[model samples]
Target chain A: MFAVHTEDLRKEFTLKKGLFERRTAVAVDNISLTVKEGQAVAFIGPNGAGKSTTIKMLTGILKPSSGKAQVLGLDPWRQRSRLVRQIGAVFGQRSQLWLHLPPKDSFELLAEIYSLDKKSKQYKSRLEMLIERFELAAFLNTPVRKLSLGERMRAEIAASLLHRPRLLLLDEPTIGIDVVARQRLRELLAQWNREEGLTVFLTSHDTGDIEAVADRVILINHGRVIIDDTIDGVRHYGAPKSADTGEPPDMQSLPALEKVLSDLFTAK
Target chain B: MLKTAQKLIAVAKISARANLAYPGEVLGRGTFLLVVLYIFLKLWQATYSESGQSKLAGLSLAEMLWYLTITESMWMSAPKLAQQVDEDVRTGSLAVKLIRPLSYPLYCLSANMGERLVRFSFNLALGACIALALVGPIHLRAEALLMLALSVCLAFLLDGLGHLIVGLSAFWLEDTSGLYLIYTRLTMILGGMLIPLDLFPGWLKNLVVYLPFPYLVWGPVHLLSTPQAELAASFLELAIRQLACLVALSALVALLWQRALRRVSAHGG
Candidate 1:
């Protein structure tokens, strides 16, 4: 079964214009999509393109105005509690960690929040592995406010994984980190997907994130999916080939790929 | 059930630790409480001497001061639940909270209670010291102290309900501070923070007796000052009334919260 499926799912927000005046705008307009289990799909769009709205709907944070949405074969809105148990989410703009406390303390709090078995050896081992894998031991005891943006992001990801969620929803998870930190995060996510078969649905402005982590790309604009294709397909479609020689342009260059994606977005 | 309890405990523990991390805030609050206590001592003394009476409504000057100490402790020690709610709603953090498996109201309640527990303990000690210095000592029984503790716990829960109501109003009202201002004053006058209900005219006192506001302060403070022999009878009746108020308030909060969740737009996301 698919990890996420939506059929004509839509959301309409009523904005108050003035006294006794209201205007309704469509945020997610009749979007039907699906992601198979273990697939890393990038949901990319410009600002105010309804990307965050869609993620919110899928995560049961917002109820849809019409149609249906199911995450892990459960209606996200109606069965939110049960669905949330099987999913972990991280939004870069907001944090779930306690800011005044250290990552280690927040991790313990999260473990309790998720109701993990304290007596289980596997739970302890898993936590230890995450701490090491995320390289959190170096500054685990440092308060979250004192941690660098890169360190905090790593700790945030590690905290999300505490529940052993099958599907991870990341919204702009690499927005403000340094280049090296961003690259490191992408690699860690890729490794996790490959080794543990973790299904990832990520929204990011950085095309580098798409190139490094996403095998499938879904381009959205005006609250609708403009293109759903493989990363290679997107690259080939947008590549500037030599007309006379019929040779494919260098696809490995990051700038070339980014330009092509932007050109495609503009063309659509 | 047990899992929910554990989650709440963890929330409270983290909140307590967070509040303690900044000692300056607590110190500032302690200083304010002492200042307020000093003002009350002088005012009550002047009123007693002017009236030329050792007792007003069966309360000596010492008894009245002790009563004020307890009531003020309840008032001053409450955590700022309304402001926290306003911040969450305004920032769209409420949406983030909804997505979690935890209940938003319960989480807020637990966190605030944790902070309140720490502040209340400190204030209680400070109030005791101030009372001892100002009014000397009064006769007290062990049973009366136990009943006083129970009354204070119930008073705290009742005060929480009042704050929850004001805070939850933020779903519809843009600013709840206006509502909170009215609530604070109403609780002070009718709930017996500024003056004991017994000191009020008979008709006003009788009317307030039927209101839930009095249960938060007057009932508890009265229990603390009640004579030892009368404690058993007074405790049973007051305990029953407090329990009923708690249930009613919980139901109202639950109903309003259900409606509020529907109206949550998560505006800033």
Candidate 2:
């Protein structure tokens, strides 16, 4: 079964041009895609490429202008309350943690919000697993306001996972962390996707994030899917032909991968 | 239904804990409360002396000061519900809240009430200390205290709904500050925050008594200062009015909330 399926999903926003003039701007235009269960897919796009719009529709934050979307076999917009219980999302630019409270407190509140019995064996085991796996023990008691960016992001992701959501949507989850921390986050995400059989839908401009976490990459631009292929396929597409040997540039190096992705974005 | 209540109560507890995280802010508010109570004491003392009356608006000098103390504490303790909602809408942070398995309006209402309760408690404690030092103690009755507690809780719910109504306008309005400012000013002036409703002219008092604002401040505080015999009788009448206002405001909030959801563009991607 597909974790996510959208058939010609579209969203049009009405833009007020003036006192009397109104124009319709298509944000996600006739986009069709599907992600298999437990598949890790990176939905990447340049700014204004409607990546967020599609995610919003999939998560039932906004109703599509037309077409249909099903996440975990449920109509997202119609069954949002039920769907949300099975889905976890983290918007790196936004926060779900209370700024002034410690991560532990926020996690406790989230457990209640999700209606997980605090004393149940399942809830306790899951919380313990997240705490250990996320390496949150050292700073769990510290207020979110005092935690470093990396520590905070780890806590944020752990908080999202508290309910054992089947599908996880991460939008730029590693946007502003140092290299070591970013690599650690990426590794943990990949581990979760692999070991837990969790479907991962991620969006990030950073090539390293995509390379490390996604098995497949879906590129969208101007409200349409421009390219949908395996990570290797996209990497090869970005690799430039070397002049001396008539061979493709090395896709292994981070800089080389970044350059290729940059070329692809601008070329498209 | 019980589960929903549990979730809301959890949110409120978290919010209250967060509000206490910054001790300096709470201390600052308490300090401000002291200055305001002292000023009220002096101003009211002079007003009574000039009028050549030991009582004004059926309240002794002590009762007037106590009444002002409650109103001032409430005014100072108000959580910035409308502004917070405005920021959430403007910044697209509301999107994060929407995906949660909870009602956003109810979550917000719970959080607001929790924060307000904490701040109100602190302000009232400090204000009471100042009132005691300045005007001595006013007569109190056990039943009156019970009535005051019930009335204050209802007032918080009603006021939170009022703020939510103003805040949800952010879905349509570019900014809600102006509207919130107007709402608060009306609550302060027409709600008898500075003076007792009994002191207003007969026609104006009659008109204001029917509005929700008076119930938010005057009614509950007045109950606290009332004599034992009259407390039960007035409490019943005031409680009924407060409940009626709560029903009306809650309806408006529910309606506005539904409309607001349709307007959620989640602008900043």
Q: Best lDDT goes to which candidate? A: 2
lDDT of 2 by residue, B1-269 (tens): 99999999999898888889888997898788788888888899999999999999889889898889889998888899988888888888898999999999899999998998998998889888888988898778878878887999889888899898888899888778899989999999988999988889999998988799999988998887676778789999999999999899989999998888777884644
lDDT of 1 by residue, A1-268 (tens): 8999999989888988999999998888899999999999999887767888899889887889998999999999899999988998988878888888899888888888888886799889988999889899999999899998999999999988888889999988998999999999999888888888999999898999998999999888878888889887676766545432566545574245577677866774
Which stretches of model 1 miss by more than 4 angstroms? Answer: A236-257, A260-268, B266-269
In candidate 2 the C-alpha lDDT for residue B201 amounts to 93
- CAPRI grade, predicted model 2: medium
In model 2 chain A, where is the ten-residue run with the lowest total lDDT? A238-247
- Candidate with the greatest DockQ versus the true structure: 2
* True-vs-predicted CA distance for residue A104, candidate 2, Å: 0.8
Candidate 2 residue pairs in backbone clash: none
Q: Model 2: what TM-score?
A: 0.96
Candidate 1 lDDT over B1-269, as tens digits, reads: 98898999899889888777777876786678778878988898899899999897678888888788878878888889988787787777776677678898888878877777777777778887888888887776778788877887887777787788899898889799999999888988999988988889999998887778888888877876677778899999889888999899889999989888777663422
Pairs that clash in candidate 1: none
Cα displacement (angstroms), candidate 2, residue B181, comes to 0.5
